[model samples]
Target chain A: MIEFRHVSKIYGKVKALDDVTFTVGAGSVTGFLGPNGAGKSTALRILVGLARPSSGSATVLGLPYAETACPGLRVGTLLDAGAQHPGRTGREVLTLGAMTLGLPRTRVGEVLDLVGLTERESRRTFGGYSLGMRQRLGIAHALLGAPEVLVLDEPANGLDPQGIRWMRRLLRDLAEAGCAVLLSSHLLHEVEQVADHIVMIGRGRVLAQGTADELSRGRGLEETFLELTAHTDRSPGATASPGAGAGRGSA
Target chain B: MTRAGHHLNDIAGAAPSPITKDEKMNADTPIPFRRLLAVEARKLVDTRSGKIIAVVMVALVVASVVARGAVVGPKLQTLVGTAGIALGTLLPVLGILTVTGEWAHRTALTTFVLEPRRHRVLAAKCLPPLLAAVALSLFAIVVAVPATAVVSEVRNMAANWEVQPLGLLGWTGGNVLVAAAGLALGALLLNAPAAIVINFSTPVLWAVVGRLGSAGAALAEWLDLNTTATPLMRGDMTWSEGARLAASVVFWIVIPMAAGLVRVLREEVT
Candidate 1:
């Protein structure tokens, strides 16, 4: 289980997460939804112990994420697919991660096979990998220790239809086996299909949180999302009146 | 029926009793820090750059022995020391490469993710290079010995091989310190070229500054680079000179290393 308690983050004068609080329960997939410039990535970074909150704290399995015993064993995270060594082969990269976690060496090959990259494991360098391939490798790396909690940010960014289906199934399977899965994506339909719970944010604040059905209500998921965030202008000086611009020009 | 019953009884007696649930739950397994270090060391050794550095050091050692034996006329010991100086130049370069490789390749994230304890990762990175420097220096001596002997035989000159064991030990220690200092500088600068240049040029810069006047010369002497410190390791320095050499090592190597460690801990890994 992952818990965020009254977490707040600031980047200079701008607030990245404003007094946010939420829980990701075990045996379920929670989709983190936010429009561009929202606190989705910041929140995820804090959860994984990469970025600290300006106030409050984040915990994984009741212990602070940074202070947990064997954090790699408890939580697996993929913040970005491109955040890896370009020179290392897929197998080498996974092996390094496994070694650090005190896992068996054979786990490296197992993860490669699990992610369907066994064939290209030795031949593919991270720098040369396709976006889809890198995504798969990232997921494989995150699963290295069979972690109980998995956190992924923008996991399906470059995936095709087939890869997307594979990712959805993998995430569901992980959750079904009693792992807490927190995934962030901009695609509403994808989240609607795969997420059991949703946390929606706009302008660095949680606007809504519940099951997809509850959040969407009677409207289409996309329409409901639009309705929730439509009035929340991301820009600081955005105006609601269309005729205001014309009136100002005439003046 | 009796025989079958006896056989069944024997089989049941042979089977071991199962462990109690409480005992199984209470069993404790300790984390293996030593094993983790070994694994990290193995990973570093298995890399392409690691192998290249090892091979190049060996080759340089051999070449140095041969060139010195053939041309320097039985001043084999001095020649080996000269070779040590040349090999010393590569030590800092290797250190720079090791640290910068993490950032250049984006592996620092993977490394930090697994260990999470940044200090342990830094320690692991430093250990291999220090060990390698010592091993390479000793190997250089071994190579120098045989080559000197052969050259002595071929040239028909009396080979005065002054094997100063303490001096050799001191030189090896100095080399290890130099490598560690390099690694620390690499961490501080976090750039290969900049760190290497700064470390390589410090002694020279001190020497140039020292040559300006009496005060400058005294300061330069005090700021001995590995080059000036080389004579001390050979036991050729006076008491005052030896103290000055030790001070130089501390200033040039120790201080920079501490600063680098601070930077590494505080700075964001880019």
Candidate 2:
């Protein structure tokens, strides 16, 4: 279970997230849809305690993630698949995660297999792995703990069609097994195919959230998504709120 | 049913899962300090930079000791002191990499996610290099013991086996302090190249400053760890020397480390 209540993040007058609120229940998949700079990553970072919220709170399993002892054991996160040390082999990355979580080293092989990485691929350093391989390694790391909650950002990036399909099934299986899954992605079709509930955000505001059919209505998912976010300013210098430049000096 | 049990009946097949009945029971338990230490220790030599620097440390220590034995004819104190000086100079670089590697390599996200009480993680990061200082000192002494004997016999010189315990302690302590200074700088800057540059260049800068006559020499005495550490390496110190050493330690190690710790604890990892 993950909850974001009125979470707002300001980075030197850039309101990355503004009064954002959402809840992800166990045994379900929530697709966090947003354009670039829509604050999806910031919100997810705040959820996992990587970034602090300027106002409001983000909690996982009834408490802030940092307060939860051994959080990696309970919540699997893949904020950046490429964030692993480049020199470490894929297996070594998983092994380190296993070691950190007090899991048996044998689990490394299992997750590698589950993510479709071969033995040779696993032994290669992460730097040499393709972007697809990096995504697989990151997925293996996230699944290393068999977490009760999963937070993945753009997990489908660099994945092939088959790999995307595999991820869809894996996520569905995890949610069916009672894991709460929060996935953020730019792929509308992938999100529609897998996510049970969709939370569409534009310009740091949640525009709409419901089941695919509920939100799509007469229009298709892509068209509905476009309509909802059509007016959002995607400019690099755009501000999220009025009077945003007022506190620029202090920010 | 256990998550692993669920996995057995799922599409993923009857593979071994990360969680089991036993693990689930202890899932919420805090990671023990020893586990963190073990992982941190492994991380020290696991990267290209960490491994290269570590290998360089060993080679330099051995080379310095053996070269000293050749030039000075196997005096235990001198050879061991050579090893100490070599380690003292290089270990700080190793320490800097160990702390900054998390940020440089972007593994801080993974590390902090796993262990969120960042102070504990920082403490764990600091210990492995210091421990290496102790372990490698023993290693240097191990090499020195045989080098002293072999060189003494080859050159037909009486071996001076006598070593001052205070000097050895001072040597080891000095290595630890300098290494801590490196760790502190790494934490303060959180950039490998930048921190390593500052670590090496600061002493040279201080050397230049110390050459500016009595005022400069006095400032170096009170503030430069390199200058204060000389008496420490030689096992010769008065109460005044000890006080001066304390002052330099505060100036070099404590203040930067405290500021670095605060920054690290409060800084966002993005």
Best-fitting candidate, scored by lDDT: 2
True lDDT of residue A224, candidate 1: 63
* Cα lDDT of model 1 by residue, A1-251, tens digit: 99989999888899989988889999899998866667888888777666678998988899776676567766788877887666667777777776666666666766776677855555576778889888988988887766778999889888889999988877776676677999987667778788999988867788889998788687756666766665554644544432332222122
lDDT of 1 at B144: 79
lDDT of 2 by residue, A3-40 (tens): 99999989897888899999999999999987766889
Task: Return the TM-scores of chain A for each candidate in numbered order.
Answer: 0.92, 0.92
By DockQ, the best candidate is 2
Q: lDDT (CA) for every model shown?
A: 0.73, 0.85
Model 1 quality (TM-score): 0.86
Docking quality class, candidate 1: incorrect
